[model samples]
Target: MNSKTVAELLSQDVTLQDVTVKGWVRTFRANRFIALNDGSTINNIQCVVDFENFDEALLKRVTTGAAIHITGELVESQGKGQSVEIVVKTLEILGDSDPETYPIQPKKHSFEFLRENAHLRTRTNTFSAVMRLRSSLSFAIHKYFNENGFYYMHTPIVTASDAEGAGETFKVTNLDIKNPPLNEDGSVNYKEDFFGKETNLTVSGQLEAESYAMSLGKVYTFGPTFRAENSNTTRHLSEFWMIEPEVAFMDLAGNMDLAEDFMKSVLSYILDNNRDDLEFLDKRLLDEDKTKPQAERSDMSLIEKIKFVVDNNFKRVSYTEAIDILRNCKPNKKKKFKYIIEEWGADLQSEHERFLVEKHFKCPVILFDYPANIKAFYMRLNEDGKTVRAMDILFPGIGEMVGGSQREERLDVLKEKMKALDISEEELWWYLDLRKYGTAVHSGFGLGFERLVMFATGMGNIRDVIPYPRTPQNAEF
Candidate 1:
């Protein structure tokens, strides 16, 4: 017989006919009921077994994490929570899982514990829901951009340049560490490497996306990005996905509008299509928050926060204005902030950003015109020469959900900025050619895909949202 997923079976009326289902057993209760899930949905379909007819050894194999195939008849469930269930006529153990050794069991496990067993964490309810929402949001991003006259460009995962200029890049090389090709200056010869030059995993696709945007009018890149920063925080990941959209002839204001609209559209799509998963996550977050202090708990539920963002306009503020607020804010005033905002050029830390978005603005905030020294060289320089036309969209919990800016179109200014920042002119000649020939004002922003998933799923850690989180000293999975 054709196999039907648990989600499909649960959604329809009981047919009172035979149905074949294949899935991993979530739990085997009293050797009679098996909670089966096949990753179709968060909810599991209950499969009741006729233990009297089954062999004792066969029934013993129906432990948690075991893969099984069951031929059964769909009928109305007597259980309180589920509406329907399967009455199994015959059961076949496709794969047996010993409860003594299976890492994931039918119990609550810490996110840290789950991180160690990243390969099997999806068997749990939380990770599965998060991954599902992540998938939905990914689709929504492409759909939103495609429907809005934007071309999806596939950017290279490996590149010769560091787009962010952070210097924390994972070097990609195929050289013998013990005895590598050396140069006359006693330096490792990168010319002998695979690409004939020093290369690394791309830090961002924005540079490449900008080139396409200039000619294509608008383009977006969604792909993996790498960073070698050794920060072991819940929010930092060594390798993650980024969604960057660059548009030609767009200024700072237009860029802000595009980002806000894009975020709302994607969030709305998830709310509509993945309500079940969101609901599950929402409840999970609420339950998790009960153990925390009252002030530490979220002001609104997960769904409420998402809906608030979707329905409300993002409060726009200038970096100068944000600086004033941060300096005068209670945290800075009381010296509670780890990094105090004392002056105009100081970069805003996570605490400061949270205060602006959560405490002061009480909504999503867009802070623009950041100090030039604190921003990237690509951002357009302002008249004052002190700040650049950069914008960061800050969410309530997530510090900076999106970072973008209006690109400096003037060739002379761009070259000067690049030289001042010590960026190689010859290496980026192709990028410079874009500005030299026909560079019109272009703008774009990068949204960390994992951070977006964390926001949508109410998952606290960046590690939990990504399947195999690549972090410093932790690449087991």
Candidate 2:
């Protein structure tokens, strides 16, 4: 008989005379019942074992985390919590896991402990559900872009440009570190490197995506991005995935419309397709919040929160208005914020963003027209020359989920901004050439993939949403 997955069997109403199912044993109870999962779904398929007919040695091998193949007769389950079950006629142990050494057991384990055993963390229910949701969200992103006439562009991973200009980039080199080639001035000779010049992992694909968008009309880059910052916070990751979409002949208003629509589309996809996983996570989050103080608890469930974001329109406010509100808000007035908002040009921190989204607006908020000095050099300069056409979408508990802007397409304005920022004109001659030739108003936004997954799965830590998280001093497996 052909093998069937737990998900397929659970969805069927008719019983099968004979079937084969292969998966790892989640739990072996009473030496007569087994809960099997193959990572196909959040729920496990129950397998009833006739231990009296089976050999003692084989029955004992049906331990937790053990790989096994079972051929059985499918029948209506008489037990609770399941509709159908497998009555095992034949059993084979593919791999045996020693209970003494195997790290994953049939019990709740702390996230910290699971991080240490990341290679095997998927065996747990939480991690498996998270991974499934992440996969679905990825597909939803591609589907949304493809349906919207946007071509998926593959930008280079290794490049010689600093897109963000933050100076926190992971250097890509093949030269020996202990004894590297040096010039007469005792400077490290980058000529000996593989690229014949300094290169690093890309921090963002927006620059390259823009080049394609100018020609292709609309294009998006979804790929891994790296940063060398040593932040150990739950929100920071050394390596993460980013979604950047660039559209030609689009203004700041069009950019905001695209961002809002794109977010709702992808989130609505999750709600429609991944209902089981969302329910599991919703309960998990409620249980987790029980340990926190009442004030810190979430008012809406995971499903309700996602539905709210989809059903309601995001609140839009200008940077000036947001600054005014923050300057007079209770947190800033009472000095509760770690970084107080004092003036107009001051950059808003995460605390201030959360206040606007969770406390003040009580919904998703889009703040635009940021101070030019605080935003990236590529953002479009306003007529007043004090602010740029940049916008950030802030969500409850997850601040700044999307950051983007209408790009500075004017050659003279871009050159002036770059020159004042001390950016090397020679290095970015090709980029400047795009503006020199045929510049049109272009807009785009970048959304961190893991951050979206974190928000969707109700996972607190960004590390938990990603499969293998990379952070400061931690890259194991």
Candidate 3:
């Protein structure tokens, strides 16, 4: 009486005398063979319909994308591609999709076209596998933290401070744009605003998570973060998810250890549990590579790339040492790099990161002790006075998988850094109180949830990983 999923029926040890199944028709071939899928797995189950016993009208309605229910006997599949199929004794059309107007057919569709029809893209094999892996990775993250004595803390979505100081926060306000209240000098008067001051969606939860870490000992925040940047690149997203973990009494070395272990654990979980989806995505990427030039093809497959990260240890290099390598590397000397590494204090771009991971080091790399002027204000300053204890974990194809640092715990030094950066003492008085009360060496790191998904799924664009992407000039479902 109850319907069994395609996955359950396929995994059965014996043939069923009677089984009920519900799914949408992927294709109806020769008016006898029907390929049905229920979004349970990448493969579909064949339904052999007895066309003579069924009404001609009902058979006609079994079009592509039509929802159908069947009561049948499960038997060994006579076909070559499948192991088992349902011998349909009765069929009912739950929903009819017109063959003339159905956008998703049983043929290959371009990723660009799929993005336009984003609502139904998951019906295909690629997006469904990608989203399934996304769900699995999310669970793995929570599992790792919970089992390791970490508290899951929910940070506020709307806050008064820009944690990253990147000046890219999306403003949250309740004021009239045309005629807002103005001050004597014509500046916008926040006295009548909702929060009575300027507020924006939080860009990071690190600052708030640090407060909790001081008392809780170990805390992490996994939630949505927003940015108002207008850049439309493959890596940039206006709204994305971030994972930040803060630990008390941890130094820069321990921070790197946590990050590396966390990443390896999550990636390994997917490989062990979500092998079907991973295999599907791996083949999809390999097929996609056939369309590219051979020179640009990847030397390793998708699964191989993932296993490589999980098996090897990340190479830890100082920022100064990396700068030296890049300054004299063939790419920089020959002007092949878009932004050549020419100086000590220059920021490293994505190209430089990939060069280190893919060509030079040939493994994941953690570059630390970066120049203080290039990092955030909360990072601890080194005794050298020019660098901080910040670190970034760079991947081969996906550069900068994680960014974190040992936080400044000294009240006087933190206050000095805040003043130099124009960060007001009054705004972060509560944060400073953590240092004043019991200042200890604390460290944490943040990984963009979408970036991890991008690497794991071999998806080129960051937007494809998230369900509904919010980007500049586009917010379509």
> Clash number for every model?
0, 0, 0
Model 1, which residues run further than 4 Å from truth?
none
- Write down the TM-score for model 3: 0.98
User: Positional deviation of 264 in candidate 3, in angstroms?
Assistant: 0.5
* Candidate 2 global TM-score: 0.98
Query: Which candidate, 1 or 2, has the higher lDDT?
Result: 2
Deviation in Å, model 1, residue 60 alpha carbon: 1.7
Which residue runs of candidate 3 sit more than 4 Å off their true CA positions?
none
In the range 110-189, model 2's lDDT, one tens digit per residue, is: 99999999999999989999999999999999999999999999999999999989999999999999999999999999
* Candidates in descending TM-score order: 2, 3, 1
- Give the whole-model CA lDDT for all candidates, comma-separated: 0.93, 0.93, 0.94
TM-score for each of the candidates: 0.97, 0.98, 0.98
Off by over 4 Å in 2: none
Question: Model 3: number of clashes?
Answer: 0
Error of 2 at 172 (Å): 1.3
Model 1 accuracy (lDDT, Cα): 0.93
